[model samples]
Target: MNRVDRLHSPFEQHSRALAWLAVFGLLLAATNLRGGLVVFAPLVLEIREALSLSASAFGMLTTLPLICFAVISILVPLMTRFFSSITLVVFGLLIISLGVVLRLVASYPVVILGTLLLGSAIALLNVLIPVLVKVFFPSRMGLMTGLYSIMLSLGAGMGLYLAVPMLEYFGHWHYPVMVWALLPLLTCLIWLPLLKLRGEVKPVTGARVTLWKSATAWAVTLYMGLQSFYFYAIVTWLPNILIESGLNPLEAGSTTAMISLASIPFNLFIPIFATKMHNQRSLVVLISLLSFSGLTGLWWAPQLAPMLWAALIGMGAGGALSLSLSFFILRTGDGVQATALSAMAQSLGYLLAATGPVTLALMHDISGHWLTALMLLMLLQIFQFAFGWKAAAAVQIKPDINTHSSKRTP
Candidate 1:
């Protein structure tokens, strides 16, 4: 088919119904990405106590899923090439559901293995959903992206907040972990109808959309990586940091829950505002400044009004993340470029991003303090600011041949 034919075909018949269905599916998939990761964060103390794990062992448990995320991200593009995005999504949900169920069995090895499986599933789904947004909801990319990001943050916040209560009600960690399985299972059922509808959709092909050579692409990827690094590191370690700062377990958990909850509004609002701007660099600077301020407040002035600082950090981080996803759709010329850039940015970006939590965990294990870890996170924000400035310049990624010819290089 010709270019116009390809563009018009996907929406020719069932556009409205299909768009709604795709949005629903995207929200469900996005919701699942952090269920496994955050649900366990609030339960870290219980796991450590029950398993009698050392500091290093506890750190390993937190870091393993991120490692899996990085590894699985590398494989997603190849997997999508052979399988339909719908098929990959369904398979990812299945794996995540199975992993959640397996966690109930609760051998140490089994728990770690389940975490890996969950991360792998999340990695695949994370990469595919943006491609779907680009393909189906081209007109409402910012709105849909914001909606999905809010759902993701809400799911994560709820997962962390509810875990202790769920365990308290059920009298065991197994049920708390197992309860999340129902989400993906329900998502899988809702998505089953799409299986029959798959082969009817045409496949993407040709020039590969070459995002690797683009400066805008690299800048966005680095920004994504840096922001993710800080977010995950803080999520994984903040409760412990609070505990070290003299709060009891319940108080620390509550603080972390509040931070996660605060992210929802910011995630929803940031992209909407960023999309309206002629260029996004000022917003990027604003977000980075907010995040740095929050982190500094948390480290230096723990005795001050901590929740306010925490909320500021949450808002900034959430905004940064939502904007990163928004840029994935906004910076591209077409669905093909969106797909390639999404795969490239998320795969390599997540690989780099995964290092933050692991590094924080290692520092906590070795130095027996959270100060060094917090400093490292502050340093990451510097990189985030630099790259985000370039990414928000409103420039598009064109071919190197055209770029060079236009520049008249010496």
Candidate 2:
């Protein structure tokens, strides 16, 4: 029998079991991506107290992981080329687990290093996920993407809300960090079966396509990067911003947690709706309006029922994120393009996005306020709206079947 037939042969006897295993494995991997970031955010003060770090140092603590995430994302395609996606994903989880363990055992400098390792692992997993969806759930891209995104959001929220309580119960920050190690470790266990499934089948070979020449490709990358820029900026600094605006630290963290909770619904619903629509333009416009309105509310009247504004922003951001993941699948004609596009968009976009939090911090440091920073963010949203309009239109990246020559224009 041929290779494709051999791959399917095992499935004939255990297709149902393998299908459920793939779904569960994907969910577990998705849930671990943002846990490190969200867990660190709520515990920043405690970490600061323990390490005696300054504001700039605190900023570095947050920024280093993002920088690592961006830098490592650029290398994921290379990693995938040398190893199967399943192998890379399993390796990533192992790295993340080690990072968490290191965080518990190490000193301040070592903790920062551990964060870098964790970020790098998460970056690889992030790029691989959509490719896996394309491979295994070709017919259910939108639905599966939506489900994974929701799991990611919910996991992030859990990390934020549970960290402090866990620390309190355990009476040490180390326990909190150490406890999360179990997640990736568990994921590694669940994925062990799939690892054995990748026996030395001659590597499926293909010619590589250059994605930089495609306008649609660049547009999608910029949109993904800019949206991530704003999203991470908010995730890293929003609590501090809200606290500076008069809310206490607990209240600020709670508010940010609520925003994350609000995303759960939007992440689950948006992709399903986007798949039914011809183009995603209307959804883009609507979400942008909601996000802008929310930002305006936060800037102008944060004292007046800020939770409503937070929820609005969360809903819009969640929808945008889901749509971006959907575009990674929809804009590509097949798995190869999906892998390339996912790598390009996430690597370049994340590198660009790494500036957002630092820029916001610098603006605040110089101006002694967040108004100008918010205005800058609003301008980014405007650009996002413009690009989203172009990217949401139906178009596919057609690669030359013989040579893998590809271009995206329409």
Candidate 3:
């Protein structure tokens, strides 16, 4: 049997109602990953004015969480050794809740500290969610992945579209940030019941897979990094680009939300679509072109056709992000290996991504034109396409099957 066949033991049967409940729990957890990340961008100008932040300082606010993702990712796989995955996820949710509440303190240091806490918290789930699919839903990987990606995109959209109204009602940025805490709180209430689940695998004690030696793993990592770099950088600056191109603040904000909305359907569609094929090179090629077209359009004529460009990037980014998440399982042997590969990709991947916001800001600051930055983003899409295609190859990672089989409980 193939490595994929070996690592993916069938999920132990559960009641239909219980399976749906697990799906509910997965979707709930996925929602929090990108919700808070979107809150800051809409409030960027307000945050800068209120806090008296310099350009680079504001950039750091954007960069900090990604740095946290990188730093925290290094420890998550190891963390699974000591804690059950469900327990670790519960801890992550609480940390996210704490971080959200922390942002309400109205002090710079405290707010920064809160942001760090939640970013670190989200970082843990980032590694785990894909693993969840591998461990528990190997039979439903693509559907679950797309569903998870859609939930995250919706979270981002909620954070974006809801911010203005939230500002109107709450009368301050801090309150909206405070409102985000409710998502984790809600997810925790739902997830808490699952901790009592019987027959789940306990943490295994053994040597971990050495992923650094694998080319497909590195392909997954770079694909994750470059796609994140583009998505975060574009989301951060696209509003400003639209505003400069003659859109009003409201329109620019709306356009930004639309980009995320566009991605939603694509995110839902891509993984399921990609799974029907042997390799996803064609999907990668399509995304690269869509990305190139949309980004270049924004650079050259954003004012002339804002919705068109936004939709292009939206679809492109959505498919790309879903594909990247899909690779966590596609390239690895099982949920355990998925967690390890996730750690490597996201730890290093996010560090690479960490530079996107700050680096783009610095580039724009130096050049005084969006052209240079947009051009660079377009160029990177090609590079991203390379990694995406290779990572989608027919060959899978050659894991230590003998050791892993002995260690994992059936």
Candidate 4:
């Protein structure tokens, strides 16, 4: 066929339109993934006071979602047998909307119940979105991953930034928390069109690959875990830390939002840059250094340079997360393997991350200082460096699978 004829082909036009639609759906969905977990942080003080929650109880608001991610992610791969990825994502968004509404109830137990629901729904979305990226943009994994990562980071920043203001405007914390439910509902509307294309983008099926046997997969898992630990720990407590350092609740919340927002640039570009490199070991080293310096500054003189510390931590954590998500695709040979690795890495990794908020809270309660927690967080950078170096190698995790029985993701 001539070039002009090929360009005018109906198949080519349809494919381009479908690609844009898929990308739009993915980006919108990404915005809902983290905002629910993050929006609660800035309003912690008001909620705790109203609910009479202890530190551990207050911590549950954030930790519950991570716990759900750890547990629910393992089952997502199996869910593919019954539902397409698009259906699962749409279901998750609806559930997330319900969870958000449930959380707005004035009762504490009801709040916890809502949080559990929300977390469970987010867990499903988390495991499958990358699978969608792998399925839809196999040749451009880095660019697509970066786009979604940026959306996640943007969601988090907006949640943190808007929560306090919403609280002020609504004259209550519940309303501020409840407002986030709209996002998932709106995203669900965006995603509904993809359901029609379900046959074209089914999930990986057949015999499951054993990613646990791969050392590189384990390294990626650990890298994901440590990076998550750092990010969640900061998200949960940074506002309180700033408060302790003499910032008012508003200032603390805004500063915390700054940390989440600062990561945007790294999230936008890191994956793209990493994909062009032979390996990402140097990037990992750079991540560790930035995090170390930020933590040190926070520990020593937070009041003097809170925004600077926030930016450094944001950049480090953002780059590390974008890279880790890329690793699920980069280190794996195909969609089936990417799904398996994502399941393993996120399940085990988030289980480890789930401990960060409560652990930091306990460390503070026991020592009556944030320094102990800060020290523990700083020490984690060393492990991040080690695992990231291993995970960043130009190595693909080759899982043993029965090719004849196994189904490739669309």
In the order shown, the candidates' Cα RMSDs to the true structure are: 5.5, 4.4, 3.8, 3.8
What TM value does model 3 have? 0.91
Better of 2 and 3 by lDDT: 3
lDDT of 1 by residue, 82-194 (tens): 56677788899999998887666647778777777887888888877876766665556667788889888877766877898998998888767776788998888778876
Q: Write the per-residue lDDT of candidate 3 for residues 1-410, one digit (tens) a residue.
A: 01122233322444545555667888989989988876887788778888887777776666788889999997887787767787888889999999888766657788789889989999999998778766766767778889999998888778877887888888888777766888888888877876755247456456366678788999989999999899888987998888877899989978887778889888987888777778888888888888889998998889988999999998898989898888887877655687788899999989988788778889989999788999999999889988988998977787655545424521
After superposing candidate 2, which stretches have Cα over 4 Å from the reference?
Answer: 1-13, 49-52, 196-204, 399-410
Ranking by lDDT: 4, 3, 2, 1
Q: Which number leads on TM-score?
A: 3
- lDDT by residue (tens digit), candidate 4, 1-410: 01112222112434555567778888989988878877887788887888888877877787688888999998887887567878999999998989998877778899899899899998888888987787777666778899999998788777777888888988988776776788888888778877776766665566477877778999999999999989888877998999999889988767876776788888878888887889989889888999999999999998999989988998899999999998988897666677778888899889988888779999999999898899999999999899999999998887755532575562
Across residues 223-258, which tens digit of lDDT does each residue of candidate 2 receive? 888888888787667888788889998788778766
Instruction: Give the range where candidate 4 is weakest over 10 consecutive residues by summed lDDT.
Output: 1-10
Over 4 Å off, model 1: 1-11, 45-58, 196-201, 205-210, 246-248, 361-372, 399-410
Which stretches in model 4 have alpha-carbon errors above 4 Å? 1-15, 44-56, 172-174, 242-252, 402-404
Separately for all candidates shown, the number of backbone clashes (residues 3 or more apart, or on different chains) is 0, 0, 0, 0
- The better-scoring model by lDDT among 1 and 4 is 4
Query: What value does the lDDT take at residue 17 in candidate 1?
Result: 57
What's the CA error at residue 158 for candidate 3, in Å?
1.1
lDDT of each: 0.75, 0.77, 0.81, 0.83
* Candidate number that wins on TM-score, 2 or 4: 2
